[model samples]
Target: MVVSPERLAGAPHPLLEGLDAGRAAAPAAVVIFGASGDLTSRKLMPALQALMARQQLAPGTSIVGVGRSDLDHEDFRARMRRAVEQAGDVDERAWAELEGGFRYVSGGYDDGTTYKVLDEVVGDLDRERGTAGNRLHYLSTPPGVFADVVRRLGEVGLHRPALGGEFARVVIEKPFGRDLASAEALDAALHEVLDEDQLYRIDHYLGKETVQNVLALRFANSIFEPVWNRRYVDSVQITVAESEGVGHRAGFYEEAGALRDIVQNHLLQVLALTAMEPPVSMSPQGIRDEKVKALGAVDLLDAAEVSAEVVRARYRGGWVGGAEVPGYLDEDGVAPDSRTETYVAMRLRIDNWRWAGVPFYLRTGKRLPKRMTEVALQFSGVPHLPFAPTQAAELGPNALVLRIQPDEGITLRFGAKVPGQSFDVRSVSMDFSYGAAFLEEAPEAYERLLLDALHGDPTLFIRTDEVRQAWRIVQPLLDAWADDPAPPVDYDAGTWGPEEADRLLAADGRRWRRP
Candidate 1:
């Protein structure tokens, strides 16, 4: 059960100086429940391996994977090796060092006896190695099993702080609830065994480099913040589109449509980061407080208002990436008469003075033409246009785009004079590309969240209040969708979305960005 510091290797990165150079605080035992699942293989294990490769992990830190599979340590390590090779870019030396940190145990979610055994195993590791009683329990299992795992950990005394002054933290995966009431229920169940600070609600979006860089882009820059208010900005658009269909997740997608899956959590977080006032400090709670305030001020949609502003659609059979894909109903595990929405486009208005009159258009969908997630801050047009009518008619509005994925970067669009004898103005983009400028690859979202958990930093993780407020903001939309008698419009695959999405923005004389 014990891991030796001498067995570990590699020097740490400059960004991880504080965490890696600290007094090799008591080693940590990270217990990942549902360790045999796809998420664990694709994200969790690879993230942990990346951290260990960077030497950010504390000395003597060990990973204990808990699952229902009857595999030995070597078998578990082999499985994780495949996962790491697929998901991580570990050098040979680093891989050897990280491989030495792996361990495994067989356990079920509802079995308290299994937790008791786990507690004993962890204690033995802590004693043999010098990990000062610090433990992080990551529940990567489904929402249905979260409560059982937490309760079992509590019953086995692993949920509470150790008598020897050790700390305990629990990290839960997303899809907090179906709606406001269910979100509250989920909170109540966890609060039984965990205090507010001891809980880390994982929202991978918060961990992205570009997303975190937003704080610097806004708060650190005086130019942007001055005009970032409702005065200069016309409207904001948040779009997260995917070019792939629901492959094997149709069962989960059926119950949780576009609204719950994307809008409720991911879109809201993006909105908060975009709209929040500057925090006094970058502390976890300080940043979360501002986010909570921003989310709380969001204008909740009423049934009628929601119906008018919202557009939902299901993608019918069509071509995506030059190949044919089945419709939602035809997807595996999808019911024949499914009514779930695969796409959602809605316009939201903030009631605060700073953004009182401005609209924030949010949209997301699957099986689209391209995979792009971006936030566009559309600026107001010139009060008076001096250009000729012919030329003015061909130009679009100015926009500042913050691209989060596919190509993580920032682009600013403005009308510029063309280099010709004739006076001609055309829209030009000033782009700041992440890949071109920074040769090193940015850490995956999971890597950032896992390292933060190890260091007891919750700055990028979602707080309980933030989660509730997010659900509160979108509650009306949920109600409207449930009560609406009309069926969603159908959009073909490999397209932007339903025609209704275009019409939603056309009402304001604006259009979704074509990228």
Candidate 2:
């Protein structure tokens, strides 16, 4: 069901006309370090097959699974095949093209022999399967082992492409680091074994169709460009809410909390895409340069401002989706005295020529009422109104909402005149749904990210500067919470968040949207 832009037959894609749609994946051997893990089965495996179905993966491309699961080549192939079949439709010829070169290396990441065997397998693929001495290494292992694995590859001389015009890249999964110091440390560790251009720091949120559509909506359409500034916009609210609690990731959540888990990477990346100015070109560096600038423009809040503008809370036990769920402390593997925060809300300002005084409010949490991610910008109200106050009392300011998931659409909301002898106005929405507008369903986020990585495009991935600025912006909050051992305030699982979050908005006379 995944369709590439080039596969639109004789028609051109309106949104991707001038921008980089990226080329088909070149011939290379994709090496997954944690092939037996949940991420491999749930996302990576399906994504690779989806690319093959869409014919984006080149013919000489092969797959190599490296894990300690005690699975041989046949066993790994069977497991991956079942995963792909369950995901969606599969092209027989595409499977045949890749199945013969499937190889598995069973060993530990810290051991030396793992790389020795991996190097042999890759060499064989290059000579026998026409892989062209190119490689795409994916680090799906735990964060603790990321450095060791990459270093091992370097020791075995597998860090760079051996042939001319061949590409070699590494795709790193997120939760990049705990804070600013750790993020810099990780960057230093990676640079020792790989160049900046060879590393892909992927954040799946950036790969979403709606997220990428932000560029086309703002740059391709002239209606949005002139008004997308502080002069016309009052405030921007971005939300990433979840209805379910952390069911299986309690151990990781206890260490990361909401700040590192969501804010540092996912939410901040989305913020950059929404707030950034138009790039000079759609090339990888051009887009990345603007994103880094947008994030760099954010004013780092001081400790006093941190306490006043940010709200962090934990979820207490309550009914969710008609079922009762336990509180965060009651969850398995969580400490009874844990000070970890499950929800966070903060109001931020970008100090620059375009967004000098406008506030960008961002919040993310689990165990909320419903699952949703969106960016809503409300325009300033008219200075004067001719109608009576009562007639327009129900009308609200115009808003443009970009729904990233669930509904997966764009909504333009404005006041519409009521059909009656007496004039009245109420807000109505003009919606654009991807399903209703296109004949093909959009690809999964991982699918697009994987293809981009294979094609050596880092536009949708995070840059080092962007990551550093994100950590710098959140470091003050980290220090404040570290100095105090006080537990975060608690709210019911089914509620939006604590009343304290509302006060954060109330201070500015703005409120969180119900959506």
The C-alpha TM-scores of every prediction are: 0.93, 0.95
What is candidate 1's lDDT per residue for 110-219, written digit by digit as tens?
98777887888788777766556778999988898888899889897898656574689999998897889998999999999889888999989888888887776886
TM-score of model 2 relative to the true fold? 0.95
**RMSD of candidates 1 onward, in order:** 6.0, 3.6
Cα lDDT tens digits, model 2, 1-515, are: 34465665655544354334445777899999999988998899888887887788888788999988899999999998988888776668878877888899999998999999999999989988888889999999888888999999999988988665387789999978888999899999999999999999989998899998888789767799899999999999999999989899998899999999999988888899889999876677878899999999999998888888899999999989999999999999999999999999999999999999999999999999999999999999988877898888789889999999888889999999988987888889999998899887788889988988887778888888888999998999999999877889999999999999999999899889998
- Local accuracy by lDDT, each model: 0.83, 0.89
lDDT of 1: 0.83
